[model samples]
Target: MKNVLTYACMILMLTSSFMVNAQLPSKEKQYLLDFNKSTHGEQWQNKWNLQEDPSTWYGVEIKDGHVTALKLYRNNLKGSIPDGISILSELKTLNLAFNTIDGELPEDIFLLATLTSLKLEMNKLKGSLPQDYSKMTNLEELSMFNNLLQGEIPNGIGDISNLKTLNLSSNYLEGSLPKSIEKLHKLERLELFGNKLAGAIEVDLGRLVNLKELILSYNQFQGDLPSSMATLSNLEFVQLQGNDFRSLNSLLRLQSSKLAVFDSDDEFLNMKFGANEANRTRLVDTKYEDTKRN
Candidate 1:
């Protein structure tokens, strides 16, 4: 009887040890470890103790023995993101904003099919956005503002059907706004302010029925505003200042009762409003000199 009891106690100890140590799959854990080492994890604000279980690591979320999220925003991560990040196949969110992470984005990152939100804003990242977004269909919010990215917005961006907020503001991105952007029927905020993007607003703006804020200030965009813009009933804020637009007459037919702010160059038209109009909406017809970021 004494021998049997001792053996039972040993079995319980081993079971508990396995439960504690076998939290993550070996491959995923190794990928995480590699990421940590490459990013100088030791210098992070909340450094991870490599000796401990990965479940206890900072900004890492594990579920069903798979890495599901990694949010290390403003944590002092100072290195370029390592390759093989797509190995975290179950990852849904990857937030590395406000870091010193530089270099062209790893090509593998666009392969994260399950990623819903990817926030890499306020970093030193440079290079053009990927041309193929077919694999990233599940992305809802792709915020990469305040970076050094250049080149035209990819036409393949329309492949992200689930996208809601597309903020690429405060970058060095140039060229005309892609017509494919009109396909984002779910997009709410389309901020492209403080860039060098030129050409007329050719796309049917009315197609984006859910859009609320359309900020295109401080760009090189010229020509008349698209007439379809008058049909955007959901628009609340519109900034078209600091451009070479030929006329603002197209906006006279705007039907949005929710239009709270409308800013444009006053030289194009003498926009006068009644006291009642002034109380309902704030219209600023002046040149915007400073870079506005949101």
Candidate 2:
């Protein structure tokens, strides 16, 4: 009778396992299956098995039975991202940087309201940024550098008050910096270098008291540096090379005693600060000195 009881216990355990496996949510299962089919699962450096649970897939993070992050950086993921991924309502971080992923960003991508950090840098993505920034209220870090995106930065971007780092460099974006940018009081680093953005530099930048490093080199920006910028007390580095600026001498008079690296293309501008007081700031035009990609 003891042996019979042991056999029954084993059968019960096997049945429970089957039940657990079968209980996998249909939405999550379909998302993985669709992603695999769309992204050419066979070619991925880290391939996914369609038959297994998505939580077990590489670069996919699951929390509380929901996908929370999809970090597939430098995985050699080619082709466009499947639009089905917008269904991941619980996703917080979506990092697909340093890949060969090409094509326009899916419009539905803006539907991800829970997204906090979206890093798609060093890809072949095209098309202008979405117009409705209000949808991404939780976004903090948006790094989309080295893409083929064009058109003026949408004014709606200022609506994302929580943004801390905004790096849209090395794209084809044009037009003046939006005046609404002053709304980002919490912004720390703003890098808009290597683009075709023209017109005078936005004077509102001085309102960003929390700004640390502001890099706007290799663009078509014109006009004098805003006097308000000298008020920033926490600034450390400011690069404004390869542009049409009237003067940067005002920046040398910043209230921030922590200013260190201030690079530009003008030899005379460099001399203006370098010729004075101990040479504390390293003023030079290193925008094209070292051989490198964007």
Candidate 3:
């Protein structure tokens, strides 16, 4: 006909350029073999790889080909922890904390919404503490201290809101400590020491107005102390030691008393019960002496 329509237009333009060159380098080697089978290919420091194996592993970061940072910290990694690491959806950063890896903690890592920093803390991981962690709203820093985690601490974690440092200290967690954490207003450091949190000692935590440091030492919190905590005033450090005090004009009516070191193993038993029943025993700083001495 016309040389068979110009050889069928050069065989359909070389079969559409060989199917776009077999799909852009096979989707960049399947994104570096799905990040080298999710780090099971162990590696320490291998600065940005194209295919540079020091003895195999962690070295395959390609830009216009996908797969970003995947740092392997304190690499003495044991076994377990492989699920193609959420297929590395252009991951921002994922540090596999000081290793000795046990189990749990792989629910697709909350789908890395441009994850900030998630150090999995000294591992031996148990369960409960991952409702997609409230969808990781660009989380700041969430270190999982001494793992073996139990339950309760996930009331959608006050929806992140760019959370600061929330270290869940010494785990085995129990209940009651979630009044929406008084809505973490750009919280500073709130370390819950030695777990088993009991109730009442709340004042909506004075609405956390840029709080400094407030450690709930040895959990088992008893009641009263919420005279709006003397208006927070960028409060300094205040550790209510041990627990179950219930006196000392209830800690000087918490007009905060210039607290830089308000440690109460029972500060002289709250000053001998606010000077021997100041109000003839209305009991435990009654409304902070009826709203600061009526």
Best of the candidates, TM-score: 1
Better of 2 and 3 by TM-score: 2
Q: What local distance difference test score does each model get?
A: 0.83, 0.79, 0.60
Model 3 lDDT per residue over 141-185, tens place: 676766788898877777776776676766787787777767878
Clashes by residue pair, model 3: 248-270
- Candidate closer to the true structure by lDDT (higher is better), 1 or 3: 1
How well is each residue in 137-201 modelled by candidate 2, as lDDT tens digits? 89898988889999999998898888998989889999999888889998998889899988897
The numbered model that scores best in lDDT is 1
Model 2 residue 83 CA deviation in Å: 1.8
Compared with the true structure, model 3 gives a TM-score of 0.30
